[model samples]
Target chain A: MRTNLMMTAAAGAILATGMTTAAMADGHATDLTLCWAAWDPANSLIELSKDFEEQSGHTMNFEFVPWTSFADRMLNELNSGGQLCDLMIGDSQWIGGGAENGHYVKLNDFFDANGITMDDFLPATVTGYAEWPKNTPNYYALPAYADVVGWTYRKDWFERPELQVEFMDTYGRALDVPANLAELKDIAEFFQGRDIDGTTVYGAAIYTERGSEGITMGVTNVLYNYGFEYENPDQPYDIDGFVNSAGAVEGLQFYKDLYDVGTPPGSSNWYMGENIDAYRSGQVAMQMNFAFIWPGVEADENVGGGNSGYFPNPAGPAGQFAQLGGQGISVVAYSEKQDAALEYIQWFAQPEVQQRWWDLGGASALRAVVEDPDFATSQPYAQTFLDSMAIVKDFWAEPAYADLLIPMQERMHNFVIAGDGTAQEALDGLVRDWIEVFEDEGKI
Target chain B: MTYSPIDRAAAKTPDGVARRIRGLSDRTIAWIFVAPTIFLLLAVNIFPLIWTIRLSFTNFRVNRPNNAVEWVGLRNYERILTDPDVWNTMQATAHFLIWTITLQVLIGFTLAYLINKKFRGNDLWTTIIVFPMMLSPAVVGNFWTFLYQPQIGLFNYVVAFFTGVDPASFSMIGDVHLAPWAIVIADTWMWTPFVMLICLAGLRSIPDSIYEAAECDRASKWRQFWTITIPMALPFLMLAVLFRGIENFKMFDLVVQLTGGGPGNTTTLTSIDLKREAFEKWRTGYSSAYAVILFVTVFGLASIYVKALNKVKER
Candidate 1:
């Protein structure tokens, strides 16, 4: 009787485990996880997800990695088939790799099924964040955030009567918001090293970080404005003449000149944080950074409110442009709860949710939300952000984007910061590196 | 009445369970106890290393793992061996290893010798000297960047005060010529105390009777130092050198924090280059070959050094 009882108990336990697994696999309530960089915007996003949780009855979990390690950590999770993330806010450059690797759920069908239309998003954002095999209409993500390179300058310094007269005398132009790169350089030169209120201040702080992709991102702003194209549109991967053109070389030289003479001491390794610190500490006359930091800069005690002014990236020889900076939201393909994740995206795409996203400090990629007349007047830098987004270009989002970015970073940093060799030579070497990598990938 | 915790725990165990444990042979128990550790070692260390070695012979990529992993025997090795960039990194590693080890051993041994004198407040001085080593290297490496700043850094201000040169005229981390030495200085500052602690132990281990006998022989203080102290402390000094040499070779975090092998790759060590290739560039096979070469170089050199250390200890 005891033996019979033991066998009966064992069979019941196995059957119960099977039934529970089946129950969970059926349409039961589930927990969904979202991952993103640990930034101010991520906090706003988490706050916004509460409503979704309440209605869906699925508690939303978040894994926020610091920006420095965000790519490394999240990509590792996706590549290793980890189920830690149901939703991901991936960088714009990650769309190609994520889509190609099947790490992200292809969202075209989902969007169609849910009445979500790509025509609603800004054109640039759709091309930048949502498209895979870029310029193609295949959607793998929803454009969640949009940002671009822009400038913030000390308005009080430019408005000083004596300084304004001196700048005019020196550069034959009034001290005001620069209309082009030449005027920007002139203003930077004028303020390179001057005493202000018993403190010696330097000129502008620009990106020059060496370890990662700081210089490439910053220099590309100037490069794009000066006619630097990654490849001939007709012939892909042919970067020889386009990337190393005489105009591109001049632009790179101009950046190098600014870095050498205008920047503060130890500015050779400055990036976003360093630029923010320099601007906030009243150590610099101007700072070039992304729009995300503008809110913080305007709220700063030292140089904020009417004391600071913001503008789009000044034009170069060929035309004006800014490097794109933003990310898109995608559902991880490996997630078991992709339906719930897709539901979250649909809810997030609502116009009301988008308006709240912007109001809560998250940059909105939706045209309807940002184009609201009240939105431009919302903050001091909002108009500048809208203007900058109009002429934005993005870096390559190829699956092997790192292979392309690392060489440019190394070459640009070596020339710009280290002051080694000419811009022509650096660009040539970069072309060689790109071609070699492309050949290895069987792309050539 | 006098039940210890272990005894009480054993007493509480069921008789059948206790009897079963006791029935196992000592060898069997030892094997059971050792099994988990061996398994962990194989899982963590040996398995990954073997996998890396196998992948080193293939044309593979971490990011492109779905693609076919083509076997190109010795091609990855060939490229790494012939690459000038790899050579540059090796040169940098050698420079850092040599200077840091030499400086640390010299400075650490001298301080250890002084502290071993049993002077007043010796313990306090030891604690003060050992303080820098106790702080996190990441923190030290980061703050050192500020300290090396040309304009507002105290380091530059102090240098200006002494040398009468303008602080804003130069930057330690920004200049390629000075960046390597800047890293050398930062690493030495953080690690010299570790060597000093080891040397201090060596110093205290020497019996006082030997010095007393030397004094009876009418040996002068300087002579005694050369004949007795130097020889006796040699083994410990070598140990410290070996430890520091191995450490500075694989130096990643501190240099990354300090210079990031920057100012035009002036300070890019092998480990930094390897990391860039592996994680940053995602060149798994190429970086694996690089890693294998570095492992062989370090392991072979360390094996020989260990043999020498053993000989010194025997003496």
Candidate 2:
């Protein structure tokens, strides 16, 4: 009798789970809106989503804001529990807030019900984009794009025999792709203020923008490789020595040095757009930007078609690492059309659809697409994208990421761009700021 | 007998309506008509002010509804007062206010004086001079950024032509020292015409007969100018200052579009800093305290200035 009772209870639980899953799978056509930054990839996604709309019978609406205001605008919409965006391709750092604040619909059950396994996606993207308490199986979003900070150099300039000879003579080595940050600096210095084709050109265009995340993203590419850990590996939020380590200071100092000696005049407030402009206009020999701009660089009339070459962020003394730049698509919790939203996500997860997304210029985070043998040869920057994504690190994804990020942006801009203080002092101040934030959050 | 329209309409009214109308007082009818405007004032202006004051005393984040709000009392106020960074922001704001006001007053008064003297095509020149002021601040900020661009900008080229410094050497918006002045220059360009117009009105309002009487007394042109011109325009000039003082205190879009308060915090005015705190960082409670402090400062200063202006008017 007890055995029968146990079996009946199990059967009832199964039936209840099925009913819940069935409730969201209600066959209905509805309008679904996806929010993301206005960029090349946004246009690509709009094109790619048409297939999903056709297949799922749900209308796809897009709300794309420029990168400058994207974070402020979308975060406001999410914070207010606004139902404007049924889906959001939010920044990776927003995962903690989205999951903890319950702005995102937890997608584990949906993934399971639809047989969408996380293993099929890139591990880095899975950890960076999906997991909230991170390294846990609890999922909030599916990785929509794979991006990392990388370098794009003027290949035509570097390949010129006369320039190469002069570079080699000055540096006592053949100027090829930099194997390390130190060598990258050397290359930048070599090209600094050099005349190219009778027009004066400058070195690399690095991110030093003070308004937003530009400097932090640029500095972290150097910081991570120089042993700047966000916190103690064993203890969370204990960032006294780890954040302001000796090597981290060296890295920060190196970045400041690069800015002072290499970058073009008036490049002090340069970000992605400025960097791209500088490179395309032949004002700079190279640019530090996200991998998403690679396709545009490859297609540009002035600097495209084998004139530009790409490379992962060069190694430093401690290790090789690049700053992760990507987003994951999460179903907004307040969305009234959950059934249609889930249907869209379901249709988006198909491998064939993922392949089409990549072909159409959207960076697919699926392993089957990126890991294929032909993927490396897919585009000029494809291999660099993969390699950079391999060595990726992301900023603090704490629920108070904005609080944490604002201080870092200020400190980094102060030290790197403004020549305000020592790198050690900047990093130490950052620790103090971050500690105060965590303390307020009851984390410490 | 012929009746006027009002008399005929009144005669046709029912006894109940006529009685109600007869019973209504002027003050009561006036209030009935004014009630909507008063209600709107309370809703839009007074309510937000009171709400902001209330929020200033608590630790409330609008984004985190689930978190328990603790009354932090004067902690937020204390933080702002003690923060060295906030003081720096204040300093930047003060610098901007002083420089922009001084430049605008000097140049604007000069232009207005020149325009007051009737010249060939004076109206045409005045229209052309006012064109900069008519353009949107956002647009001005954007175009000025290009104008300030090193090596490729007209401003740099012009400066280089005169000074013989390399156009590629120094950046207007990029240099820490120049960035503060860059914003000042742009603001003065956009708003100097506003001041010019006000000063011109003051100049035009001075009676021609007063000057003629001064001439009959054999008063020198310089003496007449200081005694008559300066005193007469003083009130209007102060009024212009008051208007500009309030507007510059909350200057946002123009500077944001130009430098974004950067090249370090060299250009970070208090308004920009407060915005970052309130919206970007979502420190609603802390920012409420900030807003209250700014409001009190502006209100207190303006009150004193207005009193001084009244005294000058009485004189």
lDDT of 1 by residue, A402-424 (tens): 88888888899889988889999
Model 2 chain B weakest 10-residue run by lDDT: B61-70
- Per-candidate DockQ values are 0.55, 0.73
Query: Model 1 chain A — which ten-residue stretch has the worst lDDT?
Result: A14-23
Model 1, residue A47: C-alpha shift (Å): 2.8
Among all candidates shown, the one with the greatest TM-score:
2
RMSD of 2: 5.8
Clashing pairs in 1: none
RMSD of each: 9.3, 5.8
Q: Residue by residue across B1-315, what tens digits does model 1's lDDT show? A: 798998999999999999889888989989999999999999999999999999999989988868999999999999999988789889989999999998999999988989888789988998999999988878999989989999888888998999999999889999988898999999999999999998988888889999999999999999998988888988989899889998889999998888878987888999999998998788999899889999999999999999999999998
Candidate 2's DockQ: 0.73
Off by over 4 Å in 2: A1-27, B1-19
